[model samples]
Target: MKKTLIVVCTLFTFGATAGTEDSGNELSYEHFVHSDKPIKCLYGYAAEKVGDHDAAIAIFEDCIARWESVYAMIWLAQIYDTGIGVPQNLEKAAALLKRGAHTQDEAGYSSLAKYHYGILLLEGRGVPVNKQAGIEWLQRAADEGVDEAKDYLQSMP
Candidate 1:
């Protein structure tokens, strides 16, 4: 019984210490995005998932510079909006989202940017509050099969 108690206490101490250590460094983006893989943005996603927001921001910025990736713009906008590893800059976030929305519309991709941008506009998060413009943007996103935008529009009497 004494041996069992010692072992349990040791295990508990180790577990608590390990939990306090920064484990984010253990998760490498290289593990997720291989050089041979066509999708390089996965590295940014992996970095963000591992709580390495600075790395994620750099990776996303690189991807955007190289490919003008609309998804990267949206992700970067979110980072700026939430102040994740950086100061909160709503205007920058709004600009990034606007660029993403335009790129998505031009590329005929999903309307995720539109949905986010519409919400920002509606709430005056980073721009002038314009319900009409916000509704129009949301309507466009809804037409493109964004269920959240559809639901939001429905909720608005």
Candidate 2:
């Protein structure tokens, strides 16, 4: 009886500890708040990962308002496009992506934004179908070394 109890306790302890162990990729809210890294963007991502789209939206909006953060704009555009926790607004998504694509930055947000915008333009998912503009945007993304854009352009007939 005692042996079984000990084994059960040990299993419980191990399970609990395993559950608490960090996955290494998760960004905690405390870290976002305390670290020097941009809090709005990090916190927004964290919130979005946890299925808190409302909080993510607010946080991303705050980031955009403060710094025109491309990450925030892209996330917001995705959320709007997907209608996650909000009404679907393709026009809004297209506008946000366009703004992000136009914003100058060294962190490659412009490339990412252009890639997504190009896809939307190509597929007519959010914006009107404009194959020429889409190809141009994809070419720009390819020039910026976006591998997906390169692959997509090559795959085109």
Best of the candidates, TM-score: 2
Give lDDT for model 1.
0.72
lDDT of every model, 2 decimals: 0.72, 0.75
- TM-scores for all candidates? 0.74, 0.76
Candidate 2 matches the true fold with a TM-score of 0.76
Q: lDDT, candidate 1, residue 37?
A: 29
Off by over 4 Å in 2: 1-37
lDDT of 2 by residue, 1-157 (tens): 2432454455345432222233333344322322224543655665676687776787788778877889789888989999988999999999999999899776678888999999999999878999999999999999998899999999999
lDDT of 1 by residue, 1-157 (tens): 2432454455345432222223343245533232222254545655675587876887688767777877778888988999988999999999988888777434443388888999999999999998998999899999998888999999997
Q: Assess candidate 1 and give its TM-score to the true structure.
A: 0.74
Best by lDDT: 2
Cand. 2 Cα-lDDT: 0.75
Clashes of each: 0, 0
